[model samples]
Target: MTVKAEPFDLSGKVAMVTGAAGGLGQCFAKTLSAAGASVVLCSRDRDRPELVRLANDLAGAERLAMDVVSHASVEQAFEVLDEKGIQVDILVNNAGVAISGRAQALSDADWNAVVDTNLRGAWTVSQQLAKRLIEQSRPGSIVNIASILGLQPSKGTAPYAVSKAGLIQMTRALALEWARFNIRVNALSPGYIETDINREFLQSDTAAAHIKRIPTRRVGVAEDLAGPILLLASAAGEHMTGSNLVVDGGHSCASL
Candidate 1:
């Protein structure tokens, strides 16, 4: 006999999405909210008009200021959540920065900046959230937004690749350590996605050449990640901790 599958429902869940002011972060917040979770749209600057507008527009959505690079900032954000009696049941660590430059010419500042935000930042936020879940004896989920570059190297993306690779490993380590507490940790590695910042470049001839290398022969959009993200964030993925789900339109399958 086959058992009925659980629904991918997040009703009554509270999800915190970092860097939700724009881009993929905003999309993540919107997706989670639509699935019935009360979303906390977090950005380094919560006072941005767009963020405020989004928070007000989405039912059961709120905005908070959080800088994942700073432990103090992460702590303060959680403290505010505590004051409001909001416990985080899901976390989307999507705040990241990419500094493209030749590895030989990369400055200490640039390398540090990328690593700090991409790796350290995720750690800071995840640690704080894990602590809260442990204290309350509740189960939770964490989805780290990684990249295809993490699995393979590319030109002028050394630091970014390194950071993402580290994050992937960190996901496994955290999942192993936190399993007893019922906190699942996983990584979501997305391929090249056309966003406001990269749209022009991605549409250029130079990008066209790169696109040919992809098996799918097309770049992904932010919405392409919605299903994978929601699966990892909800009960449907309860047994999926320590996995790195790659949604890159077959970019990683091509022979380099």
Candidate 2:
């Protein structure tokens, strides 16, 4: 008799992903769901039709309306899970916003918006997951979507860069504090993904010039992130935590 061995499959696992309506979020959701995990797509635009299509395509995937900046909203969102007896085995804090401007020209509102969503949002969602995982005696994984900007500064993106830097530190702190609960936390800092966010900019000569600096000589696609996202969320990365994985095509390394 042969005993069947399991691989990195996430069957029976439940995943909650923030920012599920966007390109990156949709990629992660589709990848994880394809790998056999029940995915919960959370975003402020839960009513959007695109989300409905995503939910239908991915087995066991669903959508929830969530605003990460509001603590009261977070609590209320979690209450639904509590009622359903759903415990998340994986959490991806993939929601973020970017604001670009010279340091002096950046408006206070823009700065606040970037920080509140990129940094505070990740922290708040992680807190919500940590509390539930600890109380329910569940072991889980958390992958926070940071940026290469977090590791180094990019010109004219002070607010966006600063928030990502903060997220890396927050992921480290959470990993240390929650290790006892068997919860792993880490960050993925992707570089120059060709998504809705930068499509127009990349089409211009100036933007194309900057993109050519990458060793790959091409911008990343949304699907380029799917494999890395799954590796961190599934059993394949069970031993890794508090580490920031940089997926930039060497753009951050070039001097010129």
Candidate 3:
């Protein structure tokens, strides 16, 4: 008798990525799709033409309107998935917002918005998806997009920093609790990536000066993180759980 060896083929795996209209989330969705996972591209607004177009191009991908901060929206989106017969094998909690200001100057709205979207949103999505995975008795993976600010911090972005720190701890706690069910939870912390949300900052002289401090001496591109994103979403990271994979050009080590 001969034994055939199978490889890291995610042929039947399904992935749900929040914030799919943004650069980082879009990269995750496309990368998972390229690796053979049927992907669910989700955003708060269902009318994003670019996201819809890209999802259509991905052959096995679909789109959903998910407001992670709203339990009703999240429930409706998952119900859509169920109706479509989609079983999510991976969930990427990448929906986030950044509000940068001195803590003393920050308004209630600014603080609430950041905390609601970045921290609570990830928790809601993870809890909902984990429940589904547990019910099905299926193994799953979850990757939450955190930030280096979670480990270190800057003075102005208190809410964003605190939210990310909470996200990292959430990943660890969830991983510990869900390990028995074969559901792995982890965080991907990217440092100084050039994306639409930060385009103006990236082009500013201050951002340029900051990039020079990095050991890599350059800013990170969206595609640079795509490979790591794919690895975690696929069987390549099957044994990895509760880890924070920092893909930041070594900036966390360099001091001002």
> Per-candidate RMSD vs. true structure?
1.5, 2.2, 2.2
Cα lDDT of model 1 by residue, 135-162, tens digit: 9999999999999889997888899999
Which has the better lDDT: candidate 1, or candidate 2? Answer: 1
State how far residue 238 of model 3 sits from its true place (Å).
1.5
TM-score for every candidate vs. truth?
Answer: 0.96, 0.95, 0.95
Model 1 per-residue lDDT at 44: 91
Tens-digit lDDT track for model 2 on 90-199? Answer: 99999898888789999999999999999998988899889989998999999999999898887788998899999999999999999999999999999988777777
Give the lowest summed-lDDT range of ten residues in model 2: 1-10
TM-score of 2: 0.95
All models: lDDT?
A: 0.91, 0.88, 0.88
lDDT of 3: 0.88
Candidate 1's C-alpha runs over 4 A off are 1-6
Please provide, for model 3 over 47-68, each residue's C-alpha lDDT reduced to its tens digit, 9 standing for 90 to 100.
Answer: 7997988887897788899999
